[model samples]
Target: MSKVKKRIRPTKEQAQELNRRLDAVVEAGHTSNLYCDCDVCQALAEQAKLMGYRTDVTIKRPSDKWDRRKREYERRRQNDAVKMASLAGQGLTSAEIGGKMHRSKSYINKLAKEFEITLATKKRGRKLCH
Candidate 1:
């Protein structure tokens, strides 16, 4: 014969005690939501919710404007473009410029095109100069 096991549930007193422990932590002040998965912890959360305390955590957000941040990033990109142009103008190869700029050769080429810059040689001799 197979026997079935029954689950044990917390008594009302146990539930209230769990609630008091959780409420005390919240009352002492926690800024983030406490994660509860255990039976006692979950029961405590339910109890505090019943006692009128918000168990939900509030998330803080950054105050910076997205538009302003985007503009700043664009300005940084433009500055990178200027640096790349100057480096290329000084006989630096596209690969060298890319290495210095921490970018791929393809990305450097794209940036050069976008900024109306060229990767042509700096001088008329030796058939080469980047």
Candidate 2:
């Protein structure tokens, strides 16, 4: 049998701060322009990356392309689903949520499924380390 690498769960304080950063970005429909050099911020950056989360620290708020900007306006529902999907449940479908949000059905469905895997309660399947 192979082993699944254990993911490091963030500290409560860390989660709070990361939540703050995310809320700030979403509320403004823009990324932050400054990187918070606080120790908690750095730890989050490292841990999220280590866990295969692709994230960018806001050293400067980068301007978004047109589509990106449009999506930002539409992000509220997706963001809500993101939180919901992260919870342990039967989970919702993209098309169901999409109709409510007026988003592309395919995209939302894909996200719902992906989030299910990533936030899965089950352990990851292991592969042979050749």
Please state the error at residue 22 of candidate 2 in Å. 0.4
lDDT of the structure predicted as candidate 2: 0.57
Candidate 2 lDDT by residue in tens digits, 1-130: 8996666776787677667766655565544534455554555566556444645543344466866878985696568666556442444445545555576766665666755533233336997899
| Model 1 per-residue lDDT tens digits across residues 16-36 | 776577676566554254443
Clashing pairs in 2: 33-61
- Whole-model lDDT for model 1 versus the true structure? 0.70
* RMSD to truth, every model: 15.0, 20.1
Per-prediction backbone clash count = 0, 1
